[model samples]
Target: MRDTLRVQLWPLPTLGVALAVVAGVGLPRLDGRIRHDTPPWLRDYLFGGSADAARSVLAAIAGSMVTVTALTFSLTVVTLQLASSQFSPRLLRTFTADRYVQTTLAVFLATFTYALTVLRTVRTGEDGRTAFVPQVSVTVAFLLTLASLFALVLFLSHLAREIRIETMMSSVHTAAERTVRRLLTQRQDPADGEPAAGDPPAAPPEPPANVLPLTPGASGFLTSVDEAALMKATVEADALVIIDRLPGSSLIAGTPMGAAWPRTGEPFSPAARSLLTEAASEAVRTGPERTDLQDVAFGLRQLTDIAAKALSPGINDPTTAVHALSHSAALLCELARRDLGPRLLRDDDGQVRVILRRPDLQDLLDLAVSQPLRYGAAEPAVLARIAMLLRELAWCSTPDQYPTINAALARLRSTVDAQNFHATEHGRLTELTARVDEAMAGRWTPGRTR
Candidate 1:
């Protein structure tokens, strides 16, 4: 029951001060007036006594007002602080509702009620000896009510600001969810080798008997020699070649089954062999690194798109957007580390030079690889953070100056081909390539709704 009431009264803060004043000041005055000029027992029981008692009651009422007012002011300050910390200054600037008007109304009603109570206490008989001046209490109550109304207005205004923030955040969250779902749906799956529907049928296999024999020079005298002679030759030679004719062909039982080719050239130049070995090793190492880089790049692109959507003026509150951007950035860095490894060293210009075997890049590799997934898993939160960061970055210059992911991609594209290490390092080299092409064609506008 308590929880239900709490939920039902969730908007209490919006009119809390006004309600407080009505109950605290008006109710007491009204109760007292219900039994005017009562007997001593009735006065003590219902309306209390003379002006002295009314004064004490008014003091209590004033104290409550002061306490609530102080608390409201403190709450306002605290809420503002929290909002500032959570949202950008630009977002905070949008909240400009007036609080004073509501507070003024609440104070006016409360004070008027208090004044009425005091006036009732001071009423006197027609003799004018020591009559209670109900009018005096009414006047005091009127003034106090005005004061309380003003306070209430201020308090309600703050509450309104909070409500506005929540509304904006809710809108942003809905927009972000929609955007994410759309992007995820639009993502292109990796290409697999599915044959085209119209491809010609595979050719039929040849019969086993159709196989050909090796060249005469390639074949050995084993085909013409006796098994005993071939065995003697094999024992004498470093290697022996043998060949066999198909079953339908005429071949003596003494003929060898297969032929061998002796290695004649200098086996392998040491330098050449080493080069071949190293090339193979490098190929083996870089294949997966390239893949990781591509995946990370795709993730980053999605993140950027999410951030851009969150930052749209209509969307509100970029908390999730900002988080997404940070996450994507971390992921990109991780992929770079995994693929580039020790080769990801910083050059003199502070650019990351992917020298595949360089040792100096280890630290950067470690830092870059460790971040993205830890923070990116919560897509909504990540996107919010990204949006906030983008807003902050946007404020530094004109909107045109905003450093978008596309811009970075364009700059990189201008200097390198799609096959370049940096380009390939990001998992979606093809997507990035497409983006670059689209950007060059003026099709990659950032603020486009989708």
Candidate 2:
């Protein structure tokens, strides 16, 4: 629900419209009491026009505001299209969640609604009715029109900057960092159900003979899992639930997403099994697409998509790919310093009741580096960036995580060895590999090999 509201464009604007309606209805009543009681100097600030003139002004403001609102919507749609076509479609969320765009739309629509609402209260001396005009309401509407015009200019400038590639990548990087902080922790003790700081990892749990399959309610990417609710259900049924699907994995309706079994060495009763299945299905949430709520890899995947698309023959933007690699490397280094292991949810007794799968360092490394390594192999600059990336990761990685870094480093070395480069290019890459070795050995070597 939180992710849905964040990526939507309507909630804020609808709120603005609702507030405008309330203000429009109530402000005129206040104007009726104060229209004729204004101080001598204050009267100069209020609308001094006749009822007919007030109606004309209100109608003009209403018409212009609605027209501008349409224009703003068109520009927004164009921006979304450009982002989806040029960058990854996942970036659309960044734009849709922009407060500036939402605020601009809200201001415009609110101004239009207010003006139209106030226009109906205008009266002229006819049929023995006294002529009356909402002086303060008209002035407020005019002020809103001015504010809307200013917002229009600011929105245009903002849209211009947001469409740039650098701005888009930075936005993605910031979001990814937040996700990393929220979902991962600095190397923790394995005894506490976290990835070991320097200890040998625990072995995977064996499957029970009598396990009950838990199917999803619908088909989509698994966005989140309600661990607390799962823990409650697990404790009540005295069972252990293992969810194999990570966030961003595709789920099919009626397919086994996970399994549950009695925590004790016993089988579940038929009635208890049915109840467990229903609760498990409700605990896992799926959506039409992936969200960064709990998916650490979603950010990396978006950056990789940009790099991959840039390297495509149609685009052939190696410089962009290199920049994307730089960002990916920073995120990878951050991930390396943390524990990337499956999450274990324990109950009050401290026994693990739920196991949620998460990507390890090796999996994230492949996701972040493999595509660029494949597509950007021909570009020396890109290869150098990838080499630098591995070196950075090696420096931050713990000893237990060293094997994964070394494996990635070996692949980088193999890629460079296969390339028929000049002596200078080959030598530079060799120096980079040496630096990775030095980093892993807890040493820093400063100087060019040349």
Candidate 3:
């Protein structure tokens, strides 16, 4: 929760509030103390007008700030709504997390507060008393107003660019790439880290003598699992834990999360059970929706969902589906170069404590082509792109991964064959599938046109 609050853009406004308080209350007070030491030009520029004039300027800026904030925020919400209807609602997180939008809103709101704060400190110099003008502070407020106008322009331009489908694909693709990097770079074990991308998929560990049922405290999609924490708990309890749910899976309350097998073949003691439950619950985070942070399938699913939506009869947009496919194919190719297959988790003493369940090369390969093939069988362009995606994945995969890739290709052919299309379109799709199969079988040269 703490991490979410810090990273999520909503809480950023509170930071703006803090900044506004300082600028509103602190700056003017400081200026009052150092009024005589300020440069003459600065003082002259700020205090050339009467006290009412200065107060009027601050009041005008403060009022304008409110209008600007409202206009920008409304524009953002409207853009998001339009984008969601045209693209996908899953993209809401991407737009909301935009640093530029967040900063723009924060700065504008703070500018309003600063002007109001300084407005209170304004005083007329009509009396015999020396002028009490907050020359520097008022000047800074004017500068802030100008900066806010510039930010408004930036926000509008960014919103227009972000609403485009291609931009959303690129953002989602970059996020998936980051998730993959974290998966590779954040390995907890040196032994685990040393395996090559070509290593055989690790065999499933034998079932423990007795499986201790672990239940979840709440319900949501299991987005991430803390492998290191789970491994530590397993070591402390002297047991082996096997996860029942994958990262992209939804969960129900009190469901059997997984089973724990004791190393000594003893029953789970009360203390051990409590420790396991707490660690398991904390180690795995559940949220309303899936994120690419740890769940590899989540990212692939986003692309798949968008493609599926694009292929719907109401939309009938094959080009968007192909655009999404390009990223999905590239991500699969990137996955081909890394080892994210299921494997053993051994503790410091080399005692296997947990067996983690992660999507392997085959799972991704299936995801990369299945949805598009299913929804887009009749669209020659979509099928052609799927065939080409399969070819690229096949070309990049390890020698042993060919069978799985071949199986996926077979499924793509079956999908194309099942669709009722004009004879010419069917023949073209069939030809494309046959070429993809040949490429998978190593008969086609690398970089050959599909």
Highest lDDT model number: 2
The lDDT of each candidate is: 0.36, 0.88, 0.79
Q: Give lDDT: candidate 3, residue 137.
A: 76
**Best by TM-score, which number?**
2
- Predicted candidate 3 versus true structure: per-residue lDDT over 1-450, tens digit per residue: 653553476677668878887887888789888876878766667645667878988899999999999998898888779767776777777877888888998988888988888888777756666556677778888999999999999988988898888998998899888888877533222354432235554576777646887766679988778888888888889888888677878878788878787888888898998999888878877888777667876677778778988999889888999999999999988887777666578888876788767887777877767778878877878888888888878766656677887788788888777888889888777777777667666566444343
Q: How would you encode candidate 2's per-residue C-alpha lDDT over 210-263 as one tens digit per residue?
A: 689999989999999988888888888898888998889999999899998897
TM-scores, one per candidate: 0.29, 0.94, 0.91
- By lDDT, the candidates rank as 2, 3, 1
What is the descending TM-score order? 2, 3, 1
> Which one wins by TM-score: 2 or 3?
2
lDDT accuracy of residue 161 in candidate 2: 98
Quote the lDDT for 77 in model 3. Answer: 88
Q: For model 3, what is the error of residue 63's alpha carbon versus the real structure, in angstroms, after optimal superposition?
A: 1.2
Candidate 2 residue-pair clash tally:
0
